[model samples]
Target: MQEHIRQLFSENIQTMIAAGESLSGPLENAAFVIVNNLVSGGKVICVGEGATSALASHFCQLLLDQFETERPCLPALALCNQNNSLQHSHQQDYLARQIKALGQSQDVLLVVSSSGSEPSLIKAVEAALTNDMKIIALTVDGSGELSGLLNQQDVELKVPAHRRARIFECYTFLLHTLCELIDMTLFPQQGDL
Candidate 1:
């Protein structure tokens, strides 16, 4: 049983390492964007579709509670929460409304999707653009409607894994690495205790 648990952790670590290799550059860049916006008084808004939405909310909680510096928590908000079912019904419009209501020019939107082609996810991307928020997209490399959303200026991070679960796992790895790096960089004196 212990060996099985160890093996499971080993595989997970391997996946995370591979994901880090695939995502390091964009992850670093995204971290810079997130930290910069946060330092400048802009909130970080993260959105994800389906299962990824849960991941998004989790990321928000982690960022709010664990990742910070002199900038404080920087207002991590999730769009698709249970309390906002009325807004969630409209999908894109809900995202647009939220962006308009909560986002500022300095804000950043972190979009997480496995396929990245889902209408609702695309709509959220468009909504973020409409609100002039910088976007950090985490998606598979091979496909997606979000290709149009990626540009020279935006921080677009891709994971090599194509499977839905694998893609989201990679996303989680990226977010965890981001949180760790941000925590250390932003609060260096704490060290790696």
Candidate 2:
């Protein structure tokens, strides 16, 4: 039992290490996209399902509230709900519909998924594309459908691990790192705040 617990932690740490090596450049690019969007009077829309949904809400709250220091709230929305009826509606495009209604050109769309194959998330990507928004996809792998939809303008932060737990763990770390980078970039003089 103790060895099993240790293995889980070890695996998570390994995954994070690998991600840190590969994702640094992409994450920086993502932060640049998000910060540029906010500076240009655009907002960020995040969408995910299941456990990823909760992470989406958390990310939005982090942006709308605070990450470390006190600063002006940023515009971020989470199209997340655990309720399958709303998330996986008959059309399986509920997030896409929401994006179409609220998303605008220059906005940032942050899509979180364990696998990039989720139909609803793919639709959301399509809507974001239609709206001319930038995309930052957080997924375990880029070999799925969502990867194909991303263009040169979009950023893909793929976790190095395939295990759900490890991927989710890396995601949380990645999101927090992004928040920190954004704060530092946007509030260079306000770090003590």
TM-score of each: 0.82, 0.93
Would you give me the overall lDDT of model 2? 0.89
Query: Candidate 1: TM-score?
Result: 0.82
lDDT of 2 by residue, 64-94 (tens): 9999898999999999533466533445777
Residues 89-124, candidate 1, lDDT per residue (tens digit)? 664566666777887889898888778787777877
CA lDDT of each prediction against the hidden true structure: 0.76, 0.89
Give, for candidate 1, the lowest lDDT window spanning 10 residues.
Answer: 66-75
Query: Model 2 misses residue 143 by how many Å?
Result: 3.7
Candidate 2 residue-pair clash tally: 0
